[model samples]
Target: MDCDVLVVGAGAVGAVAALGLRRQGYRVRVLDAGQPMEAPTGEAIDPRVFALSPASIELLESLDLWPRLAPRAQGYAGMTVWDAVSGSDIRFRAAEFGLDGLGAIVENAALVSAAQAALDDVEFGAALAAVDETTDAVTVTTDDGRPVRARTLLLADGANSPGRQALGIAVSGRGYGGRAIVCHLRSERGHDVTAWQRFLPSGPVALLPLFDGRVSLVWSADDALADRLLALDDAAFSDAVTEATAGRLGALHTPTRRFAFPLRRQTAERFTTRRCVLLGDAAHVVHPLAGQGVNLGFDDLRALLVAMPDPDVGLRAAALRRYERARRADIAQMSQGIDGLDRLFSTANPAVSTVRGFGLHLADVVTPLKRRFAEVALGVKPGFPSASG
Candidate 1:
């Protein structure tokens, strides 16, 4: 085999995967169709950011990548979620859980840069064209007709993964018929280092605190509303956001460019074949209502690493099966929970809204229940009983 493992995609997850495997003394080859993202410069922040759980932070620290990301990461100590229609709210504090913060918000480009910097050999502009798997090794043919072979294949190519398609893996789920608009805005008041989210009938709008006074906004809305919001001028759009969030952070202004992507809930029929395993968005896509998308991907990587501590046995079918079994339940539970919340909040029914509001209220006051939710968010607890099977 050309290498111990061939990673097809150098996004945050893929690059980090390569870094982790290389640290374990494995010969790993990484391929990506695009060049590495340039590190963010100046005062501007990349609109694409992730809320990294403690578990994810631990993984990055273990791989010696956290030092690079820590400078730019912004930690949030509390989170407040509320219902716009029913005026119900729930708050979570890291202090309540005996932690400094729930999670840190890190820009995507920064993470990619850090991971890429830690790894010496990531072949950019190389795309996977074909895959030939056998009993012992998996070989990939690049679009340029270059052949790359490995003991096993790791597909982190993303939700629309060509690697997954090449393996004839099928993903099943429907789009939410909505899009999430993300950008940075300067709020009049400080965010108090709190992550704020309000569920409108259309969707959920989140304002995550940044190191700077500005907040990162992720507003998930239905198609029509999304189009309308995107069509508005900067002032009007910012005003709409202020209204949607009920002026929680005061009048928002100085908005950055807005970008939106369609929402979907997808899961691969299977996470592993005989010699190849899928990771990150390649295996599952969840709604962004909970800001757990990238974190789930990190969780996937951590589980795979734990299952495959030694490359000698890690490439075997049994180890791959162990990784798959450990992750599927957590991913499914998170996907279903986020999808359910999206559906629940998207409804305009008076009765259902009232009930959900009451549920949120109850969850807020119930210490044990709230603690459990916090544990899941922190990634300290898995959605299933055995996250490490």
Candidate 2:
């Protein structure tokens, strides 16, 4: 089993990476230990949804996968965020940026399914048993006793990537003593095409709109609170969520089954070694408060593809190092920024609260600075590939 590139995960990021490489005429083979995601159906919103940035949307469009997902996506025209304790609120409108919306929210499974459909083949339930790298190529052994050879092996298997560990790549991260609670809820007031977030002392709570008049909930809570909330019955949990959100959308109810995952900050010490390289969560995992986890993964694909557009060029260590260096700085900046903001909000000191409030208000009133922030968040600024191209 030899190919141009071997993608070690079939999730949205890995699938999209494989699709992009294929578009560049690479004979790509994707291997995943998990089963393929089924196409979503029915009226209910998938509990796992991603707020796709403009750059992510463009990446999908460039790969010709956005059209398959567009009808199922919900576009938010504005974003409203406030501090639960300080009463400081900031709103960003799409009209202000002359864009239709801030971003599109699509189910995670749907995006992967769409990307899978575009691929020629993906080896499902194929756990990687071992990896052997050489100067010119890499050989991967699967659980089924099959061997795969490729010029480059993309280890996008996620945060706790086995490939990275097998190759002895170190990672530095710490548990944030918090867990994210995710679910879908029906709000009393319409979401109004606005993505709302309220930063509580424990963590931030986001109510992202869905296409079917519902909103997805992402509550980052302290570990104990998360356990307590999850232990409650559905009705009680919904009430807790409504209270936590201050009923901004009137009242939230009809919550789907809740899901929770521990929050942490992780960064791979090295992004590449030999003929293998890390991508997406495999390289870094940041706070979910900003909803940029998957977006960062897409950016990884964009950077890697741009650096080495063709597989035939071979996966050179120098090229991989360039991609690693380029992404490390941006990842560090985002990781630090989000961590700093989380710490700032977590503090209960009145003086810190006042300073934070003032900063949010100042950014809101300053048009140039606000637009610059928006551009950075949307990934439409310079240094990224455009859909038009």
Indicate which candidate wins on lDDT: 1
Off by over 4 Å in 1: 375-389
lDDT of 2: 0.84
lDDT of 1 by residue, 299-366 (tens): 88988888788777787778889999999898888777677777778777999999988988998989
* lDDT scores in order: 0.87, 0.84
Worst 10 residues of 2 by lDDT: 380-389
Per-residue CA lDDT of candidate 2, range 1-389, in tens? 38878999988889999988888888889999998788899775678899988778988988889899998999887888888778888888876766656788999988988888788588899998889999988999998999999888999999989899888899998989899999999999999999898888888899999988899999999988998999999889889989988999998898898999889999999888878889999999988888888988988888888777665454677778778877888888878877876887887788988988887788789877565555444443422235422
TM-score on alpha carbons, each prediction: 0.96, 0.95
Q: Quick one: best TM-score, which candidate?
A: 1
Compute the lDDT of residue 366 as modeled in candidate 2: 88
Screening candidate 1 with a backbone cut-off below 3 angstroms (N, C-alpha, C), the clashing residue pairs are none
lDDT of 1 at 167: 95
- Note the clash tally of each candidate: 0, 0
